[model samples]
Target: MAFPMQAGPGENGVDLPSTARMHDYWLGGSHHTEGDRAFADHLAMVGPLIPYLVRTQRALLRRIVRYLLGQGVRQFVDIGSGLPTCGQVHEVAEGSDPPARVLYVDNDPEVAADGEDLLAGNDNAAFLALDFREPDRVLSDPAATRLLDPQQPVALLALAALQMIPDSDDPAGVVAGYLRAMCPGSYLALTHSGPDPQLAYACEMFDQMKFGPRHALYLRDPVAVQLFFTGLELVPPGIVPLPLWHPDPERDPTLQNPGQVPVHVGVGRKPGFVD
Candidate 1:
């Protein structure tokens, strides 16, 4: 059976719920549509703790970006970068002593549009519409190359977005391809929903969602998540729950219960020279 036609801005068919938009709503962003809000509300009903988990993931992204900046990484390629909400990559990176340059990539046109508007005056940031599964497309984009120095270390953010890349898309290969293209000393900070016992029931709920099969969530175990960083050297406290991966008490007082997030995160560095 064919899924109902889904439409985005300017499309005539019924407006479909977008994962990016729904995620924006979860993060208290203003870019989501009514349909996105409805879906988010439904998600809350089924997985009451989902919003909190989302918040935790977002906070973790901030911490990771800060850590990358401290490591002297000033270029970032944010694949699957969703709607530009508060505390976005550029905001976090550029806020550092030496600002960082970032390329925000997302497949959703609406998200691309919003990102463009949000990054309008920031010369350090650029938004491009590209499916993250196509690592070559992301790396080869003219804008990405223009803004980021290939010889310098870079940070590739794959947070919370990999779970949406179904197994058939060769998620592992896609990640490896990105790592291969990045210069040595580049870092990949990734987070994903996992098959935690506490959230097993949420998986079933997500399966029943009407957002279309392509947007369905694919939960992986810790081993599978770690596989994405195969050749790269994982940072300390490797592949642990979101809060447990270098949780900063100053940034988030909720570190008291790292397990409450119900997701896994890790940072891996492409091995070799970095300048």
Candidate 2:
């Protein structure tokens, strides 16, 4: 499924690198351009552990989906879902006993266009071209309302995406808005890069990259990251490094190295009545 790298004239122009595409490239996916690869390679040079960190993030998403499936969650809203690569939410969630419904959201024109095309024949899944910051719009969007029942438990995934939402955007409020609209048993699985002293040089390098403000990275402390899960109850290992979150021996065999990854991951449940 080869998607257009450049969605249209001036939309996702080949001149600019896409953060989503770079992520795909880091995960060894084929949906990225040379510019994306170059950026990823630069990151790897600055922070040799970044590629491994990304892989860890990917493993966590898979684990979270499987865990949600085990809990009988059949609907998902993956906000800021980048380009559809391997182990997408739909594939993992639908693989359960009863297939799941997924609505992927992204403001990137290229991602939305390609995502809709990717799920063309899949009735249970869809993609929306919307920003996650506007929780009201996202919750009320026709596609999301049509596919997901707000009265039921829907797994909301903010994986690796929240970092793109800077402090001025009031990301915490955005998360709370989603939680308020969700039913009691609904779950929120999120992962964000944590501030690390070891990554100072990498951070410097990232600052130099001078990507668009939308693509700029924001590394938040545990306290700030935990705020996103404010009203929810953490599952376990509360806001630990990505490798420590429900460390699945099979999926992730290298949990022994706790400090290997600088990303933080967690899953929390919204307290209330369950349907």
Candidate 3:
């Protein structure tokens, strides 16, 4: 009972779908392959409101970085950094008082390749082929140290990526391992998909559910999502449904409906750290 060899899709013949491609399709972007399209369309048809929920999660990440910069953080390790994003971590850093250095990590070679191409000829930035599940490898990579000084206060971003790890990978432990490896002053910026009871329960209604029988998952509850932030001090407003966590208030008027868009997000600091 082995899963078919899933490659990083566009990068080789191993034949696998990527979180990045699925996201691209969700954002109405065209970089996805036929496989990506099929999955996205299926998920949308099932819930009929997943894309908007997906974008709100991105908004949550933006809010977290702006808050982190306000706290004097000057370095970032954006694990799960996938395809080129608009006004991402580096952009948010530059918009702050003292610029921050950032390291982007991902296991998909195609994602790492695309990231490198997007940041072509730029300094103050670097991307590595690393997976969040392997925190030790991510923390020890030469490139990680090259672009950032861990001793300095830093922020780690998991944003919408943790669910990709299967239950067997020990997702909670993986999160704890990263926190221990980060300097005390480090921060974690995050978001994740969660289940809502009224969102259509018909199996027949589900089109892609792409992770298929084992490819994807959702946190399902606030407690499960909050457990990932264990041993950290939550920033004011704490972990709550995405749109409710310090949003623009004037953000998009469309965000008023909780059911149409669902997500859980938060920002936490490793206690026992200083500015």
Candidate 2 per-residue lDDT, tens place, 1-275, comes to 11112232225554566667767887788887888787667666766776677677778788889888888899998988887677788877766767899988888877677778889999899888887888899989888888988778988899877777678998888888888888999999988877776566666666687532233567888888888888899998799987788778976865768786777888999987784
The residue pairs found clashing in candidate 3 are: 42-208, 211-215, 211-216
| Prediction 1 TM-score vs. true | 0.88
What's each prediction's TM-score? Answer: 0.88, 0.89, 0.82
* lDDT, residue 209, model 2: 70
lDDT (CA) per prediction = 0.77, 0.77, 0.68
lDDT of the structure predicted as candidate 3:
0.68
Strongest candidate by TM-score = 2
Query: Between prediction 2 and prediction 3, which has the larger TM-score?
Result: 2
Backbone clash count, each prediction separately = 0, 0, 3
Q: Give lDDT tens digits, candidate 1, residues 72-130.
A: 89999888787667678888776676778999887777668878888898888899988
After TM-score superposition, the amount by which residue 194's alpha carbon in candidate 3 deviates from its true location, in angstroms, is: 2.4
171 in model 2: Cα distance from truth in Å?
0.9
Error of 2 at 19 (Å): 1.4
